[model samples]
Target: MALNAAVALGSMFFGLVALFRPQAMPGRPLTSPGSQMTQPSEATTYFARMYAARAVPFGIATAAVCILLPSQAAIWLLAAGAIELLDAMVVASRNPREAAPPLLAVVVHIGSAVWLMTA
Candidate 1:
């Protein structure tokens, strides 16, 4: 599979997981398995579900556009990358150490989009 497919698949998978099992999300205080907190709160659960609600559709649309319309893919891909950038910024503000992966994702998405446009 192509890198874009992989990225979209990952996003969809995680979104689905978060939607169905918000407590399974990593890094979340009370929700995450690795976290020390024992009790889950409504706020975290709400955020997890909301993230899934937003991310799942975004992933699908971006992947669909990239496949069905390559020229338009650049815009979609950049949008996907921008989401990662926003996540990176948010994560960085909370925990700098946890921001690397999202930042890398931003690079991959944006770089691929740029290459597609330039090609």
Candidate 2:
């Protein structure tokens, strides 16, 4: 129970950090050629919006699952952590800019998720 709560809180914290400090994301070029590319991709703007828009909902759901069903919480938390980490990795690999924040963020997020799940 305590573990789940911690995971939920941690997930929320990381998500919020990503939302508020996206620019702080590291491992990507400060100004990648991709940056010139249209963001949220015109076609996928919906997906991007969905992610950004629902960040709160996802966090809430994660908390609910954690509090209500710890066993199942891990799957969702893991998925969320994996997604964030993978996004960071993709950004890092594709561009060469700042590698500190994104890398650190990913590590923290995944580390917290893993720790919470195991706890």
Candidate 3:
């Protein structure tokens, strides 16, 4: 439960940052780092904002499930784990070097879910 709450809080923080300051967020650039496009395009910014918007709801839902439905928290944790795993995969596909953070998130989320399930 505590781990879920922490992940939720972290997600909310990152979501807020992505929504408000897309450029500052890592992995927002649509183009490869070696690409000549030094600046992020409007479409990239819009996509980042959309991604950030999604994070907000996901974070809120996870937090709510942890607080209001303790018995169902494990399921929510597993869902979050799956999402993180996907995120890691996407990042890895794009740039293996930049995949560390999402990969870490994947491990933590899935590990927590497994722990919660066994608890």
lDDT of 3: 0.74
Query: Per-residue alpha-carbon lDDT of model 1 for 7-118, expressed as tens digits?
Result: 7667777789878777676665354455556545677788888889878998787777767776768878888999988877876876788888768778878998989889
Provide the global lDDT of candidate 2 against the true structure.
Answer: 0.53
Q: Per-residue alpha-carbon lDDT of model 3 for 40-85, expressed as tens digits? A: 6677678778878778899888888877887767777878878777
Estimate TM-scores for all models. 0.80, 0.43, 0.76
lDDT tens digits, residue span 53-75, model 2? 55556656766876787666556
State, as a TM-score between 0 and 1, how close model 1 is to the true structure: 0.80
TM-score, candidate number 2: 0.43
Candidate 3 residue 65 C-alpha distance from true site, Å? 1.8
Q: At residue 81, what lDDT does model 2 achieve?
A: 64
User: Between prediction 1 and prediction 2, which has the larger TM-score?
Assistant: 1
Model 1 Cα shift for residue 95 (angstroms): 3.6
Which one wins on lDDT?
Answer: 1
